[model samples]
Target: MRALMMPHRIVMLAVAAGLVAWIVLTGNWSWLPKYAPMIGQGVWRTIWLLVLSVMIGFSLALPLGLAQASGPWYLARPARAFCTVIRGTPLLLQIWLLYYGLGSLFPGIPWIRESELWPILRQAWPYALLALSLSYAGYEGEVMRGAFASVPRGQIEAARAMGMPRRKIFARISLPLAFHSVLPTLGGETVLQLKATPLVATITVIEIYAVASRVRQDTLITYEPLFLVAAIYLMLAGLIVLGFRWLESRQPRRAA
Candidate 1:
C-alpha cells in the first residue's frame, strides 16, 4: 500500500510546491505585509462568525434532531419540515431575507423600534448570524438524527435491561455513541460552515473574503490578497481536521 501511494503523494507535494512558488513569484508581497493586520482582523471575524453560528446552530440542532428521531409524528413532522425548508433554500437568500427583509420591517413596528434590542436587531451581523445558524442547524440536525439512528439497538436494549433510567441511557450510551459516530460528519459540517462565513460578506459582515476584496480594490493587485485569504482558509480547515483527529483519537475505540 505504501509503495502504491508513494507516487501519488509525491505528485501532490510537487503540485502544492509549484502553486506556492507561482503565488510567491506573482503576488504583491509588499502589500501583504502592509495589510497583514487588516487581513488578520478579517480572519478573526471569519473565525468568530463560524464559532458563534456553529455553537448556536448545534445547540438548536440537538433538540430538533431528537425530535426528528423520535417516534411521534407531531414532534418529528415540524422538525422535518424545518430541516427541509432551511436546507432547501439558498443560504444567501436567507441572509438577505433576514438582513434586508426583516431588517427593513423592524422600524415599522413601533414597540420593536423603541426596545433596547432594536439596536442589535438592526445590525447586519446579528441577521447574518441568525441566517447562518439556522442553515447549520437544519443540515446538522439531519446528521445528528442519522447518527442517533445508527446507534446499536442491542446496546440500547442492554442498557434498558440493566434498568438504566431513560435519561441516563441517552446520556451514557445513546448520545455519546451517536456523537462518536457523527464526529467526522460534524467536522466536515464545521468546515462547510467556515466556508459559508464568506456569505455573510454579502450582508456587509466584513469577513476575510470581504477584506480580501477591499484589498484587491485598493491595490488593484488582485491575486495576492485573494491568495492570502485562500491560504488562511486552508489553514483553518487543516486545523479543524487536526482537532477532529485528536478528538477521535481520545475516544475509546469500538470493537471491530
Candidate 2:
C-alpha cells in the first residue's frame, strides 16, 4: 500500500486533480447534455471494436504464431510473410487500403455486390474491424511466435517421455505456458489497440474520438472535448493495467 504514495504517484494524482478542477470550473461542457447519448454510443462502439478485434486477432494469431514458431518451411514461410506484411505496413495505410481501396472495389464485383453478405461487407465498420484485427494479429503474432519459441525444449521432451499425445501436450502444457508468459505483453498491446481505435473514425465509424470531433465542431471548443477523450482513455488504460495486475497476482508465485 505504501507503494501507492510514492512521489510519482502523488504527482500524478495532483495533476489529475488539477485537470478535474479546470474542467469543472473553466471548461465549456454546455453541449454535453445534448450529446451525452451519442457519446455513450461512441464509447460502446470503441469498446466493442477493441474487444472484437483483439479476440479475432488473438485467435488468428495463435495459428500464425504456432506456424511460424514450429511449422515446416512451407507453412512457416507464408505465416512469416503474412506477419511481415501486416507489421511492416502502417496501420493508417492499411485502414485506407481496406476502406478506400478494397471497399470501393467490392461494389464492382458482380457476385460480391449481389451477395447476401454484401450489406455487411459494404459497411465501414467491417473494414475497420478487419484492419484492426489484422493489425493486432500481426503484432501479437510476433509476440506469440517468440513466446512459443521461448517455451523450454525440455518440456516437450518430458511430455514425449511421458507418452503424452502431441495435441494434449500442447493443450495442457505448451500453450498455457506460452500464453501465461506473454500475458503482460498482451495487456500492453491491448492498451495500444485501444489507442488505435481512434483511427477507425477516418472511415466514419463513430467512436469516442468521432464524438469528440462532433463536440468540437458543434461547440467550437477544442480542448474540453479532447480533454474528456484523453481522460476517458487514461481511465480505460488504468483499468486494463489493474486487471492485468490482478491476473498476474492469481498466478502461483515462486518463493525465494
Candidate 3:
C-alpha cells in the first residue's frame, strides 16, 4: 500500500507542478476566468451535436447495414456503392457539398423557400450534424455488415435445419453475436466521431476549438486557450474510452 501511495503522490505533484509552470508561461489566467462561460457554452454545443449525430448515425446504420448484408443485390449493391463513395470522400467536402453545393442546386426546395428550414441550413450546426451523421453512417454500415457476415455458418445452418425462420434466426442469434463481435470497432468509431466534432468549428459552429479560437483572437494569446481546449477534449475522450472498456469487460469472454 505504501509503495503504491508514494508513486501516486509523486505523479499528482508532478502534474500540479506542470500546470503551475504553464500558467506562469501563459500569463493570462485573468482573461480565462472572464470568457470561461463562452467556452462552456461552446462545449455544450459540441456535446449536443456529438450526441445527436452519433445517435442518428447509429440508428440509420443498423438497418442499412443489415440490408446491405441480407437484401437483394439491387438494394445491397447500391448501399455498398453509396457507402464506398461516402467513405472515400473527405468529410469537409461532404459538409461543403451538403451545405453550399446542394443548396445552390435546389434554391427553391419546399419548406425551405423563404422558410424556416432555410435558416436552419444556413447555420453551421445543422450542416455539421448532417455531415457527421452521414459520414459516420457510411463507415459504421461497413462495420455492421462485416460483423453480420461473421456470424458462423454452422450456427445459421443448424438454425435453418431446425426449421427456424430467417427472421427468428437473425433476431435470436445473428444480431447479438454480430454486435458482440463488432463492439470494439463500434467503440473506436465513436471515438473517431468525437474527435471529428472539432472540425465543425471550421464552419463557424462554436465548438470547443472554435471558442478557444475566439479567445485566442480576442486576447491575442496563442497557446493558453488551445491548451485548455486540448485538455478538455482529452478528458472527455478518456471518459468515453473508459465507458467502452467497462462495457467490453462486462461482456462474457469467448473461448480461446
Please write out the lDDT profile of model 3 over residues 55-154, one tens digit for every residue: 8998878877888988888889888987899899998889888767765765667757677677666666777899999998899999989888888999
What TM-score against the true fold does each predicted structure earn? 0.90, 0.93, 0.85
Best lDDT among the predictions, by candidate number: 2
TM-score of 3: 0.85
The regions of model 1 sitting more than 4 angstroms off are 1-15
Reference-based lDDT, each prediction: 0.89, 0.92, 0.84
In model 2, which runs have C-alpha deviations exceeding 4 angstroms?
1-16, 254-256
Which stretches of candidate 3 lie above 4 Å from their native place? 1-20, 24-26, 105-107, 114-119
Counting clashing residue pairs in each candidate, in order, gives 0, 0, 0
User: Which of 1 and 3 is ahead in TM-score?
Assistant: 1
Q: Candidate 2 on 1-256: residue-level lDDT in tens? A: 7987999999998998997998879988888899989989998999899999999999999989999999999989999999999989889999999999998788899999888999899789999999999999999989999999999999999999999999998898889899889999999999999999999998999999999998888878898889888888998899888988999889776597
Better of 1 and 3 by lDDT: 1
Cα error of candidate 1 at position 3, Å? 7.3
In terms of lDDT, model 1 sits at 0.89
Candidate 3 clashing pairs, residues 3+ apart or interchain:
none
Candidate order by decreasing TM-score: 2, 1, 3
